[model samples]
Every structure is written in C-alpha cells, then in structure tokens.
Target chain A: MKLSELPFNTQAKIISVDKKIISRVAAMGVIPGTEVKIIRASPLGDPLELEIKNYNLSLRKQECKLIEVEKI
Target chain B: MSKNLALIGNPNVGKTAVFNELTGQTGHVANWPGVTVEKKTGKMDKEFDVIDLPGVYSLSPSAIDEMIARNFIVKDKPDLIVDILDATNLERNLYLAFLLKELEVPIIYVLNLMDVAKKRNIEVDVDKLAELLGAPVIPTVAIKGEGIDAVKTKIRKIFSDGKLAQKSSIPVKYSKEIEDKIQRTEELLKKDAPHFLSDKRRWAAIKLLEEDKEVIKEISASPNGIVVIENVKRFASGSEEFDLAGERYNIISEIIGQTYKRDKDMITTSDILDKIFLHKYFGIPIFFMIMWSMFEFTFRVSAPLGTLIELGLGALGDLITIAWPEDAWYTSLVLDGIIGGFGAVIGFVPLIFTMFLVLSFLEDSGYLSRAAFNMDRLMYKLGLHGRSFVSLILGFGCNIPAVMSCRAIESEEDRLTTILVNQNISCGARLPVYVLLGGFILGDGATGTIIFSLYFLGIVIAILMALFFKKVIFKGETAPFILELGDYRMPTVKYTGIHMWERGREFIKKAGLIIFTVVVLMWVLQSIGVDPDTGLLAWGTDPENSLLAGIGHLFQPLFAPLRWSWIAAVGIVFGFLAKEVVVAAFGLILAGEEEPEGLGKLVVGNLAVAGVAAAAMPALVYGYLVFVLLYTPCVAHLGAVYKETGSKKWTLVSATYGIAIGYILALIINLIGGVYF
Candidate 1:
C-alpha cells in the first residue's frame, strides 16, 4: 500500500519510493530496507510524521503517497 | 598548513552547539539551521579557525544548505572536517559522515548529544565506531562543555604533527558491481583529469556514478570528460544513486549494529511529549495558546523595561536641553534630532530583546518545527509549504530577518512569495504605531485586542496575497513538505542570551546608523521654511510653511480617503525610513505646531481638529492601523528582499504590492465605516 494509507502507529517497511524524490528520500535515511512507523498524522491528517532510523520526519500526505510500503 | 575546520552534520545534530562550545562564540545554535541560513566562522584557541557550515543530510545539494555545505567542503578544502553525529541517531547521521569521508579530508567524528543519548538508554562503543570509520570519535554533551578539550587537543596535535593522524586506513566498500564501477570511473578521471585526481577522485567517481549534475558539469569541462561520463552512464544499471545510498546505509547499519545499543522498548521523552503536543485536535490550539502567551509575556515583561529606557532617554534629552544654548543650531540638533529621533527607535530595544528571547527559546526548544507541522495544512491551502510558516512567525519580530530566513524554503517561488508577503506581518517596529493608534481609539482596555486584531489582519492579508501570487505571478507547483521534527530540549541560558543580544545589537546599530541619519535629515527638512511673500528659504520657522509640510501636502491626497491630515500624511511617508520613525515624525511635526503634549493626546487632538467625529474615530483609527500593517516595510527589509532575491523586479513588486494592498484595504474600511458609524 501507499505509505500514506498506513494506519497511524503501524510499522511498515518502505518497498520503493517514487523516482522523482527517491534520492532525497534515501538521503534522509528512508530506503527500501528501513523500518518506519507512522508516529502521528498532522492535526489535519494530511502530513504524516514517521519515525525512521530513530529520528522523526514529517512528510506531506501527497509525498507520503509516493512511497510504497509493506505493512509489517 | 591550513588551520580551517568545517563542522558538517545533519540537521538538529547539535553541530553549531559544538562549534559554540569549542570556539566560545555563539553562532545561532538552534534546533535547525534552515531557520538560521548562514555559516559562521570563529577562532578555536587562536590556532584553529572553526567554520560552521549549514547542516546537511548528504553531500548531494538539494537545498541551499546542502549546496553550501557541499560547496565549502569541495571548494575550500578545509584542513579538518569535524563531522558531528547525533549519538542517539548515529545510524542516520553516519550517512553524512560517510559522504564527508569521501571528501578525503582529515575528519574528527564528534558524537554530540551524548547526555541525551544516555538518558534515552542509547549507548555507543566509541572505539569500535572510530575503528570502523577510520577516525577519532569523541563523545560530547556540547551544551555542558564535555569532550571539548579532547577535540581541541586533537586539533593541536594535528597542527603540531603537520600531518593528519588516523587510527585505521579502512575504506567503506560498496557492493562488487558498484565498487567495480567506481574503480573504472576513478581510473578514467586519473587519466583524463590528473590534476583533479590528487585530492578527491574517489568522491568525484562516486558522484559521477550517482550522476550528480554539478560533478558531471565539472568533469565534462575537462579533456576526455564527456567520454568518461558517457562510459560511466553506460556501465551503471538501474539507478546508481540509490545503489550508492543503499550501500552506504548497509555500511552504517553494520557499524551501528556492533557499536550502538538502545532500549528499543522505551519511549523517548520527545515521543511522549509529541503525544499531547502533536495531538490532532489539540495541537493547533496548543500552538496558538503558546504563541498568545509568548506575546503576552513579551509585552508584559518588557513594558516596564521599555518605560525605564524611555524615561532615561527623556532625562538625557532634558539635560541636553538645559545644557545647550537656546536658539543655537546645535541645540535642536542634539535634543530633537539626535535624542528625540534616535531615542524613539532605541526605546523599543527592550521589547525587541524580550521578543527575541521568547523566540530563541521556542526555536531552541524545538517547538518551532512542531508549530510548522501543525500549520502545514493551512499553509498548504495558502499555496506555501509548511516551512514558510516559520519565516512568517519570525516576521512578527522583524521583517528583515524574516525575508532573509526565506532561504530555508527549498522552492524559489515559495521563498520569494514568503519574502514579498512577509512585510505585511506587523513587526516589532510597527507595534508602537499600533499601540498609539489603538490606545487613541479604544483606550488602554482594548489595546490588546486591537493590537491582536491588527496582527491577525496582517497574517490574513499575507496569506491571501501569497495565494494570489501563487495563482497569478509566480505560478508553479508547490514543493512537497518534508520537515524534521527535532527532540525537545531545554534552551541553554548562554545560547539564548547570545541570540537575544545579537538581535538587540542589530537593532541598536540600526538606530545609531540608519535611523539616526534619517532623523537628522528629517529635522533639517522640517527646519527649512519658505517665506510666502518672497518665497525665500527661512530657517527654523513655522512648520506650516516648511519643506516637510510642502512635501506632506503632496502626499496628503493619497491618505485623504482614510481622513488622515497633512501631518499624518507626513508621518506615514517618512515611515519608509523605519516604522518607529512614524511616531517620531508625529512628535516632530506636533512639536513644531505648538507646545508638545503626550503622544496619545496629540493623536486624539489632531484627529479632533481634522473634523473626525467620535462615531467615526474607531473606523478611521482601524483603517489607519490596517494601512500601517499592510504598507511597505522599512528600507532595511526592502534591501534584504533585494539582496536575498537578487532581482530588482521582485523588490519593486514587493513594495508596490504592499502599498496597493494597504491603500485598498484602508479605502474599503473607510467606505464601509462611513455607512455604519
């Protein structure tokens, strides 16, 4: 499923990221093998905060949709 | 031998904190450098020159900060690269450290935030990590000055030895295929560009494989460069960039597995706090509440201090009046021109410092990022990304820094739009005008509400203009928001004090330089009068016949819709010099009229004489307040916008847009109020 569709607080592994932002996403430590947890969605539920590599990152829902993740 | 050391790290890794601790110089060490977009250089014990570059996640330049960090390392080639790694998040931070390793400089790995890591039960085997990375790793709690001496001693040793000392000569190896590709590229570079191969051929090779445009451009300019690039591209499979990053992560994960240990089940303090702070419904309200309290705290705590400075300046002016001989040119110059004009601007210093202190606290505490996170949806609706909200909040303190801080926004269109709309946000300089007008119309009881409404109005107008610009002028796709939410930490007193003092010093400098000269020129213009009978220039005569009045009369019609008199017109025109000068202008013009009274009384009396009825006072005052709120920012801010955007067209657009919007808003307010009141 798209990473944005993952329920809050659920753990997932990033499978692949959209090519346009793949390098940026990978540089930020979100690669195919990294385990990520949706820590929290923003108040409006559009931007989702994810915990990856023991650090927190907030990404917009549209951008999050670009990342294909497998629910673990 | 070079003595330069560059501090490189990911965002929120306490890189600047370590720089400050080592150099004893505060270089805006906040949770993020994206907000403070400037490199700082300082001396380390008079031997090593420490340069703090902006934080970056990788060597690749996506944002301006990354571009700067990468450019400095490649171009400047500092002797020692102090790669700061957050001990708690070593796995991610080591990604950048690996990139720095490619730069082929002598690197000292500083594992900062050791205290926080320990508190969270995260431990690192310093020796093991050092062995793997082939550098010396020093664990530090920079805010408390731990491990700083070790860093300094290492630097001293490097200087004494005249060569870099390493624990090991290990190199990070990628997969066989990637390694083969890199070796081929390196061989080609060495053959075709032997001059450039001495220092960082490995880095250039890797970048070529990753297809870094800048690196490709540099290499393609050399002999056989195009042939080498074409050869490299043909050999690379799917995506070499992703492969390099994944391989780096593999190396980092292996090292971290051996050296790092953490209590995986324990929830961090940041996560616990984020539960309440980032709550879907409560987050935004909590953000507003914090902001409201900060504003209240700023005004309440600084009000007495502001009055104290005013009274002190007033007494100093009184002394000057008594000491100087009456009717001498120096008398007016010293008392009115120097003390009256500059003192008015300087009097706001205490308040400005208080606001800066609160802002610094927010920034250092890491709440500013959360505020941006909460406001992301709303900011998105306005066609600006979430990060622009940080610059907007900064606009309340000062617009010059706000405009400059737009560098943090990754997209060019969004940054420029933020800069253009930032001027509408009521800055600290405009607070005095609001206070005076609000107090005149609604008295002290409603001053808070009035001022709050004006600030709110400025924000609304700013957002509307941003949307309009996004749709019409600078049409483009808005960059997707991706922000790092850092850990919440208590702000160090020294850091906060230095930040507050830096801003206060800047404001004082402006008062002494720009405001001081502008006020003197204003005094001269007001002093020169034209005699009606012969049209001969007369000095220190009736202000009604002065050059300033004639100039005021020319612009008076523009403000006629808002019912502003000639003096008010003059005040608003000179306000372009500095917003604080608006109040000083009124004082100067009124002092020339008759016996000077309290500013509040003068404003009320002037409006009464202008035939402004009590019923229409609120609307007129509100309209004037909105005008001041939306008008063109001070000259310093305009200069900042020009410098930041590097386009005269954008600067002119910003100024003209502000004036047009302010006039239209005021006219609408007047027309609507005339019918109701």
Candidate 2:
C-alpha cells in the first residue's frame, strides 16, 4: 500500500520510494524498510507529519504517495 | 600556528550557538561569492580561522544549501571540521557526520545540547563515541558556554601537536560490490584526476561513485579520464543496487546502539506541545489568535512611544518655524519639507521596533516552523510552498527582509513567485497610511474591521495571484514540502534582542536617506509654481497652482474612475518612494493648513479641497487604501527583489505587477462601495 494511505498514528515500514524524489527523501533518512509512523496531518490535510528515526519530519501528501509502505 | 576549520552539521543542531562559542562575537556574515546563502567566517582567538557552512541534511547536492556545503568542503579543504551534533538525536544527526568524515578531514565531534539530552535521560558516552568515530569528542551545552574549553584545547593540540590523522580508521565501509568499484575509481583518480584530491584517493573514489558533478567535470578535463568516467557509467555494476544512505544509516544505527542510551518510553515536552499545536480543529484558530494578539499588541502598546516621537518631531519643527519667521525658501523647506516629511515617517519607529521584537521572539522560539506546518496545506493550495508562508508573515513587518527570507525556499520557481507576490502583504511602513486614512474617513468603530478586512484582502489577492502565476507563468510541479519539525527550545534573551535590534536598525538605515531626500524634493515641488496673477515661478504658491499640483494632475485622470482627488493621486505617486510619505503628501498640501491637531484631521480638513466630498471620503479612501496595500513596495524593497532574483526583468515584473493588480482591486472596491454609500 501507499504511505499516503496509511492511517493516522499507525506504524509502517517503507517498501520503496519513487526514483524521482529518492535523493531528496533519502537525505532525510527515509529509505526502504525504515520504520515510520504517521503522527498527524495538517489542518487541511494535504501535508502530514511522520515520526522517523527519533525525529518528526513533515512531507506533502503528493510526496507521501510516491513512497510504498506496509502497515506493521 | 594559523589553521582553518569549517563548522558543519545538520539543521537545528544548535550549530549557530556552537559557532558563537567557538568564535565569540567576531563572526562576519557574507554571501558565498555569487550564491545568496550567507557565509559566516570568523577568527578563533585570533589564532585560527573558522568558516561556518550552511546546515544541510546530507552532502548530496539536491538543494542549493547542500551544494554549497559540499562545494566548500571539497574546494577549500579546511584543516579540520568541527562537527556539531544533537546528542539526543544521535541516529539522524550522525548521518551527516559520517558524510563529512568521508571528506577525510580530522573532526572534533561536539555533542551540543547535552543538558536537554540529560533531562530526557539520553546519555551519549563521549569517550566511547570518540573511540568509534576516531575523533576527539567534547560534550557541550553551548548556550551556557559549557565544555567549550575542552573543544578548544583539543583543536589547539591538533594544530601544534603535529599533522592531522585525517581519515577515520573505522570508516563505514560500503557493500563489497560498491567497494570494488571504489577501489577501481581510486586507481583511476590517482592516475587522471586533479592532483588536489589525489592524495585523498579514498574520498575521491567515493565522490566519483556518487557521481558528484564537480568531480566528474574536473575528471572530464583529461581525455582519458572522461572515457574512464563514461566507461564506469556505461558498464553497470551490482553496486548500483546498494542504497548508500541506508547503508550509512544501518552503520550509524549500530554505532548508536553501542555508544548511546535513552529511556525507551520517554515522551518529550516537544511531543506534547506538538499535540495541541498540531490539533486539526483548534490549530487554525489558535494560530490566528497568536497573529491577532501580535498585531494588536503592536498597535496598542506601541502607541505611547509612537505618540512621543510624533510630538518630539512636531516640537522641533515648531522651533525651526520660530527661528525663521520670514517667508524665505529655506524656512518653508526646513519646516514643511524636511521636518514635516521626514517626521511623518520617523514617528512609526516604535511600532516597527515592537513588531520586530515580537517577530524575532516567535522565530527564535521555534513556533515559526509549527506555524509554517500549520499553514502548509493552505499555502500549497495557494500555489506556494509552506516556507513561503513564513516570508509572507515576515512581510507584515517589512517586505525587504521578507523578500530576503525566501532564500530558505529550495525551488527556484516557488521562490520567485513568492518574491513577486510579497509586496502585496501590507508592511509596517504602509500601516501609517492605513491608520490615518481609515480612522479619519471610516470612523473609530468600523476602523478595526476595516483594517482587518484590508489585511484579509491582501492575503486573498496574494493567494489568487500565486495561483495564477503557478498556472499561467513559471508553471511547474509543486515544490515538495520536506521540513524538519525541530525540537522546541527556549529563545535566549540575548539572541532574540540582537535579532530584533538588527532588523529594526536595518529598516531605519534603508529608509532614512530615501525618506529625507524624497520628502525634501516633494516639498520643493509643492512649494513652487507660477503665481496665477503674475504667471511667474514663485514659492508658497496656492498648492492648487503649485508645481506639485501639475505632477498630481498629470496622473489624476488615471485615478478619476475611482472618484479619488488629485491630492490622493499625488499621495499614491509619492508612495512609490516610501509608503509613509503618502500621509506626508497630504499634510504638506492641505491648503497649507497651520498644523492641524494631527495628520488624520489634516487629511479630513483637506477633503473638500482634494475634490473628495465629506460624505464620499470613506469610499474614496477605501479605494486608496487598497491601492497602497497592493502597489509597488518602496524602492528599498525593489532593490531587494533585484538582489535576490539577480534579474532586472523579474524585478520589473515584480514592480509592474503590483501596480496593475492594485489598480484593478482598488477599482473593484470603489465600484462596490459606490453602491453602498
């Protein structure tokens, strides 16, 4: 399933990220098999937050859709 | 021994505080030659020099900041790197540390914010971590200047003791497949690559494998080297499958397990605050309350000081008038031209300073990021990045810094669009015009709502324009929102005060001379004209027959559709210099009135002579207010646009677009208010 479809506050494991945004996202320490939890979405819900590697990183929904994830 | 050291780390790792401790207060900030990224360099105890690089997530060149960081390290080859890390965020922070370590520079690992980590029960074993990374480790709580002596002692030892053992002994080794290619690249680099990195074969190898643009371009200088790079590219290797970042993280996870410890169930204060601040339903209203209180506090609290300044300038003008009672040109020039015009703008210093203080406080406290996060969804819909929202909020204080603030934005198209629309976000300079016009013409009770509606209209128009620009001009995919919601920390009193003072001082410096020169010129124009009876150029003529009146009349027909008078048109024309002069224009040409109680009354008293009827003042001024809100920001702001964009064409676009939109919006307001009045 897509990371964008993950329920709020649920834990997930990254599968693969689309090649186009890989370099940008990879620098933030997001990569295949990294454990991530969707913390919350913004007020209007287009940009969302995730708890990854002991830090909170925010990403737009358009970006999240490019990452594949499986709920753990 | 004179040595060079570069300071680098991931964003929000207390890097600036660490730099302050290392260099004291002697740091000089400048741009990196051509780039807009600020480069901070300073001398360490007058013995060693330190260059502070921009914070980045990694060494890879995805963003302009990252590119600069990578280029600085590779090109300058500083003797040692002072790598600052957030001890509490050991895993994420170590990622960049490893990338820097690959540059083969001896590093002094400074674990900053140790006090916060101790409170959270995260203990980083300094010695063990130092042993693992093969560097001298010093634990520091930089804000208090704790543990800095040890870091400095180690730096001095490395310089005087002998040459550095630059490369890490226990480097994070790549996969076997990647290692083979690295070895092959090493041999090729030693033979064909520049002699600069030849001695540093291992680092050059990794950079080549990473396809670093600089490394490739340099290697392309040699014909044989170009073929070798092309060969490496054409013949694929299994090493390509290895995720370099993930591999580094995996090794860091190992190092973290051995060298760091924390309570498993510790939930920080930052997490708790994020819950309420990030709450969906209450979040937007809370954000608005904060903004409202900031503006209201600026208005109500700054009133006393603002009034004092007004009275002081007014008294000085009165004294000058007493000294030169004659109808000489210099007397009117000193009294009505220089004093009157400059005084009108200078009186708002208190309001501007107070606003800067509050804004600096907000930016330092880390709520600004949450504010950006909260506004992200709305901003993205408006055809702007979440970061643009921060710049627009800064625009409310002043647009010069607001336009400069767009450097944080990564995408070029998004940054440009934000810069273009920023002038519409009414700044502190424009506030004087609003209050004077709104209070006198619109009445006290409705003025509050009137001011609020004007601000709301600015945002509405900014968003629509951004959307239009996105769809019609400079179109591209949305700039991805990738922001670190860093740990919330208390803003130090010293830093916040400095930030506030510097910005407020900057505004005065930029505005002072421009306001003086333009006001003086306007006075001369308004004071001179042919005496209608004698048909000769003379001073203190009827302002209707003054030289200034000719300039105002030249543009009067352009604004005639709004039923605005030539005087109001003249105010808008002078506003192009600085918005505050709009009111000064009114005060000067108010039928030469003898110092009415205040500018508000002066504007009201001149309505009949301005060709604006008393009953029609509100509608005409409402249109005038809209024009001021959206028209070209002052000259200083346009200069900032040109500096930031580095394109004359874009600066012209930024200027012209505002006037076009201002006319259209103001006309809409006038036509609508024409029915209600």
Candidate 3:
C-alpha cells in the first residue's frame, strides 16, 4: 500500500520512496526500512502527520502517495 | 582578527532566543520556524559579532533560506557555529548538526527546551551525546536565559584553543560502493583542482556524489572540476544521495539508542490540544473563532486609544490656533504637514502594537503551526502555504506587519505571492473610505452592506490574483507542506512582550519615516504654484493654481468614464500618503464650494459640481470604492515591502501591478453600473 493509505496508528515500514521526494523526506530520517505510523491527519485531511524518528512530520497526501509502504 | 559566531537550528527551536541572550539584541522569537528570514548581526562584545541565520533542516538549497544558510556556512566561513537543538526532538534536531559536522567547523551544541524534555520523561545523557557528535554540549532553556553562560564560556574556550577540529575519521561512513565514489572525487580535487581545494574537500566529494547543485557550481569554476564531475558520473549510481542521508540516519539511530531515553506512549497536552484544534470537522471553525477573537481584540480594544491620539493631536492644533490667531504659512505647515502626517502614524501605534502582540502569542504558543497545518490544504489549492493564511488575516489589521510576517514562509515563490496579493485584503484605514462614502450617497442603511461587499470583493480579488500568479508567474510545483507540529509550551510574558515591541517598533521607524516625508512633500506641492497674477512660481493655497490641482487635472480624464471629477482625482493621488488621508484631502482641497455641515455630505455634494450626474453619483461611488480597494498601497505599505523584500524588482512589481489591475476593475464596475439605476 502507499503510505497515504496506511491506517492510523498501524505500524509500517517504508518499502521504497519515489526518487523525486526521497532526499527531502529522508533528510528527516524517514527512509527505507524505517518504522513509521500515521499519527494524525490535519484539519482539512490532506496533510497527514507521521510519527518517525521520535518526532512528528506533516506531509501533504500528494507527497505521501509517492512512498510505497507495507504493513509491519 | 575579529571572530564571528553563528547560530543555526531547525525552526521553532529557540534559536533566536539564544541569539538575543548572547548579543543583547532584541529580535522577535516565536514557535514558528524561519522567523529570522534574513540573517541578523549584533556585537557580542568588541571581539565577536554574532550572526543569526534562518533555520534550515538541511544544507541542500531547495529554497531561498536553504540557499542563504548554505552560502553563509560555505562562503563566509564563520569561525565558530552554535547549533541550537530541541532536546525533546533529539534525532531530527541533530540531523542538521550532523550535516554541520561535515563543515569541519568547531561547534558548541545548545540543547534548548530541556525542561520540556524532562517533562516528557525523555532522558538525554548530555556527555555521551556531545561525545558522539564531537562537540561540547550545553543544555539551555534559552527564553529563561538558563545555561547561557556555559555556552559563552565554551565559545571562549574553543576560540582560545586553536589546534583542534582535526579530521579524526569519516563522518557516518556510507556503504563501500558510495565510499569508493567519494574517494574518487576527493583524490581528483586534491590533485587537479588544488585552486578550489580546502579541508571541506570531503564535504564537497559527498555533495558531488549527492549531485548538490551549489557545490557543483562552485567546483565547476575550475576547468578540471568538469573532468572530475564527469569521471564520477560514469561509475557513480544516482542513489548515492539517498544512501548518504540514509547512512546519517542509521548512525543517528545508533547514537540515540545508546544515549537517549524516552517514554513513547505518554500522551501530552500538545496532543490533546491538537485533537481539538486539528479535529476532522470542528478544526476550521475553531481556527476561525480564534482568528475572529484576535481581530476583535486588536481593533475593538484599540479603537478608543486610537481616537484618543487623534483627538489629542486635534486639540494641540486648536491650541496653536488660539495662541497665534493668525492665518500664516507656518501654521498650515505645522497643522497639516507636520502634525497631520506624523499624527496618522502615531494613531497606528495602539492598533499595530496589539495586533503583533496577539500574533506573537499565537506563534509562540505553537498554535500557529496548527493554524498553518489546518489551513495549508485550502491555501495549497490557492498556490499558497498554510502559513500564508496568518499573514493574510493579519493584513486585514494592517498590511505593513503582514508583509513582515511572511518571513516564516520558507519558499521564495510562496512568500512573494503572499506579499503581492496581501494589499487587496482591505485594511482598517480603507474602512473610513467605505463607511464615510457609503453613508452619504446610499444612506445609513446601505453602509454596512456596502462595507461588507467591498471587503468581500477584496478577498475575492486576492484569491483570484493568487491563483493567477501561481499559474503564470510562479509556476513552480505546488510548494511542499512539511512542518513539525512542535510541542506547545506556556509562552513567557517577557519574551512575548519583547517580540511585540520589537516588531511594532519596526513599523514606527521604517514606515513612519516614509509617511512623514510624503506628507510634508505633499504639503509643499499643494502650497507652491505659478502665481496666477505674476505668472511666476509662488507659495499659495489656491486650488486652481496649485501643483497638486494640476496633477489632479492630468489624471482626471482617466476616471472620466467613472464620472469622477478632477477634485476626486486629486484626493486619490493624495491617498498615497496613507489611505486614511483621502477623506481629509476632500475637506482641504474643495475650494469655492459650499462646505457642507458634515464630511460625508461635503464629499458627496462636490461630486455633482464636477459634472457627475446626480443619478450616477451613487454608482460612481461604488466604482470609486472598488478602485480604492484594489489600487496601490499607501507609501507606508510600500516602504515596508521594500524593507522586507530587499529587492527593487518585487517592490516595483507590487507598486505598478495593483494600479493597473485596479483601473481595469473599476472601469468594469462603472460600465456595468451604467446599465442600471
């Protein structure tokens, strides 16, 4: 499943990220093989907040859809 | 040699608070990131001048701020760097610090918000973390001035000990494949491009493998640099960029596992608040409630004080009238030029002060990030960020500070778009034009609806222009919305107060000076003309002979389609001093007409004398309001635009674009109204 479709609070690991956005998101420690979870979605429900590397990062669904993920 | 110390951090990490403590300079600090859009410098004693650069998550130049921080770190090469970190968010905060390690500069790590970390039950072994990063760490609550002396003492110690910062080992070594690629570039640089070589060659090698454009541009200055780059491009895989950043995180996880401790399951106040503030259904309503309350607090509370300043200035003018009892040129200069020009700015003091005070509090409390996070989805559709929403709402209060607040927007394209469209938001000063004119021609019953329509029109135009600019001018991919919804802490009064005063004081100094000069210059222009009888230059107040009236006649034909006279043309031109002055200009410049008992009637009564049909006057007033709503901002607004943008191109775009659009829109309004009553 894409990271955008992951259920809230369900643990997952990033399988592979699109090369277009890997550097920026990966810079914050969201890389392949890292455990991640969707903590919350923002008010309008487009930007999802993910808990990874002991911090919360907000990314819009447009970017999140590019990341391929699998349930852990 | 005079040395410099630089402060770098992620946004909302108390970096500017640390800056203020070290330099004794008061720049604004808030929970929002990128508050220090441009670097600020101050004397840290006679020897060291401290520089504060805007926060960036990484050294890659994806945006203007990233470019700014990267250039300072690479080109200026400050002697020492102070990396401020949020202790609770250790792994992510250290990401930039890890990147800085590649610079090979001596660093003193400042771990701020330690109290918040402790409350979250996170334990940081300071000594171990410092050793892992190869730096001295001092934990601080920078807003409270805690651990500040330790940071200063360590800076002194590092500067005194000259023989340090040697390359001990590789910084977070990548896999063997990428390592070989780095070695190839490093060896090439040390041999053929010695002219461009430094201790940062290893960093440049890593950047070359990552295809970092700024570093590539630097190395390309030497001819051999192309050969080196082409050589690397042959054997190197494109995934080295991901591998390198991945390796750094791998190393960081190892460091955190050993030295950092935390309770991951503990729910905190920020989370609870976010549940309501970022609620699926209620979030936007709550956000707007807070915004409306902020608006109410700014104007409703400051209205009396604003009136007090205006009345006080009036009484002083009355006193001068009583004391001299003479109709002299000096009296007019003092009353209209000096007092009138400067007094209008002083009236803004209470309103601007309270507006920033509330905004600073919102930003410092961590609610601003939530506001942006919630608003970003809507704003992103409009080609702006969630953060631009705050600046736009603040524009309703005044556009000067609204433009200044755009600093927190990281992308240059988004920020410029926000500033360009901000003036259409219809500020408080513009309200006087709407209310005073709406009542006289249309009566008191229609005034409220007219004011509402003009404001609604301003917002619609602002949204349309934003979309227009995005599709045509900016054309960059919609900006990414990556934000850290940081923990909310109780904001300290001392910090918020200082932030308010510091930002408000900027309006007084920069915008204030511009308003004063234009007001006085307008006075001089209205006073001088070719003497009607002598046919020579002379100082007089005759409306038919003055230069201002002549300029008014010049532009009168442009508005002739709207049925406005030359006198109205003169008022619009004088409105440039500030929007609030347009009403007073009508009262001052309408000579030889029966001065009606009230201002609204005076403005309305004179339009008929200028060839506007009595039936068409009301419709023309609507066109006039539309023109005022869209036209160029006041001089004070332009002064602020120039000061913040520091680019003559953007400021000139702001000045000219609005007048063109305003003219076209107003003409459309008049033509359509010509069909009806």
TM-score, first chain, each model = 0.92, 0.96, 0.95
In model 2, what are the clashing residue pairs, if there are any?
A: none
Interface RMSD (Å) of model 3? 1.2
- Error (Å) of candidate 1 at residue B622 is 2.2
Once fitted onto the true fold, the runs of candidate 3 whose alpha carbons sit more than 4 angstroms away are: B26-37, B163-180, B383-420, B427-453, B471-476, B529-536, B577-622, B634-657, B664-677
> For residues B201-231, what per-residue lDDT tens digits would candidate 3 score against the true structure?
8888888888988778888888788888888
Candidate order by decreasing lDDT: 1, 2, 3
- Maximum-DockQ candidate: 1
Q: Name every residue pair that clashes in candidate 1.
A: none
Candidate 1, residues B1-677: lDDT per residue as tens digits?
43888888888888767888888873433322333466588788776788888877876666777877888778887878888989888888888888877776778888899999999888789998888898889888888889999988887886787667432224567889989998998998888778664577888898888888788888778788898888777777758888888889998899999999999888988888898899988998899899999999999998898889889988987787788788898888777676666666666778878988998888888999999999899888888988899999998889988888888888889988998899988888899888767876577799999999999999888988899988888887888787888899888898778777777777787877777777888889888989887789999877789898888888888777677887778778988888888877776666534435466567656642266667776777788778888888798888888888888999998889888888888878777777234
Model 1 alpha-carbon miss at residue B233, Å: 1.8
Look at candidate 3 and tell me the lDDT of residue B277.
88
Residues forming the 10-long window of minimal summed lDDT in candidate 1 chain B: B26-35
True contacts kept of 3: 0.84
TM-score of chain A of 2: 0.96
Task: Evaluate residue B131 in candidate 2 and report its C-alpha lDDT on the 0 to 100 scale.
Answer: 90
Docking class of 3: medium
